[model samples]
Target: MMATAVVLDPAVTMRTPEWLFLSTGIRAVDHAVEDICSVTGNVFSEGASMQALRLLSRGLLGAKARPEDPAPRLDCLTGAWMSMVGSQSGVEKGASHGIGHALGGTAGMPHGYTSCVMLPVVLRYNQPVNAAQQAMVSEALGQPGTPAADLVAGLVAELGLPGRLRDCGVKREQLDMIAEAAMHDRWIPTNPRPLDLAGVRALLEEAW
Candidate 1:
């Protein structure tokens, strides 16, 4: 969604409230994943990304606690829109999205489920390069001082979403192919740290 928005209008800039209300559901999930691994130096974009995650966490939790309430639903939608606010036309997504595309395109995994399983592992793998950002992510998700990966995994579990690649029917044998494909994904170049086949494979192994 952010990718499409960037392509359609590179000059686009979301308003503050607009961003807070825009990110939700799977779109919020995508934003959170992308921000964690992004190398872009834009502070506003990074801050918005973290806020999107925080909003998403609140929205999801509210929705879970009161399924009949419409407020949480609206919050989620707003969060989704905000999540994509700073995405630029030429900027690529990071490893979670890149790997997710490979998994979805090659392995036929559902997009949301792909994120559910891969995001935590991607965060953990990229932590060395982006520990501060990851810490922000953890705080946004309401888990200060905890490993971002575990906090993310906990969120997935709380949402009753798949938390492991194997749980989503991803076979161990397919990791190599997925890793190879991820290495070539456009998003790989924009990852916070360099990504090689070996590193990609290691991330995949952890996801598996």
Candidate 2:
């Protein structure tokens, strides 16, 4: 059942540890990136996705630079909410979200951490097909001309979050299983860049 209304309060989120907050904030960043780059995306979702990136990047970095302040988390919340708007509009996410699910299911990784590692890898893999769209993502993240993948990795690094599969303790042997599982995810087919099983495996290897 869908809720008729939703409410968000940044005050209630302060109790969460800083590291965890930063990790999930990256997941919100991943959402915006995926929404803007999805094969079926439109201008309405692109607008919201760009705004989400703007707010998340500023707010997440602000929190990293000033952990003593609680104000930036409100920006994060608003940005995350904007991401939900794009998602709810049926703008499908791509291989990043798909591979992230495989990591969660096959290796017990959190969606946030998986996003940190996989979003960059997936963006790089898709870049050849979607460079123009990705340029917009990098610009929204405050770094035009930088690869969107590098910008995301840099943002994750600034937050002191883990940025690799090794950092999350996933073993190399698991890459094959994760890749196989990722192929079955609904979002994989919707990726802006077409991905067969080999492409999925290549992405996992890069992340690993």
**Winning candidate number (TM-score):** 2
Give candidate 2 misplaced runs (Cα > 4 Å).
none
Assess every candidate by TM-score.
0.82, 0.96
How much is the lDDT of residue 33 in candidate 1?
52
lDDT of 2 by residue, 56-160 (tens): 999999877876676887889889888876678888999999999999999999879998999999999899999999999989988899999999998888788
- Residue 23 error, candidate 2, Å: 1.0
lDDT at residue 96 of model 1 (Cα atoms): 83
Local error of candidate 2 at residue 84 (angstroms): 1.2
Q: lDDT per residue, candidate 1, 81-143, as tens digits?
A: 667755642335688888988998888887777777777777777888888878777777778
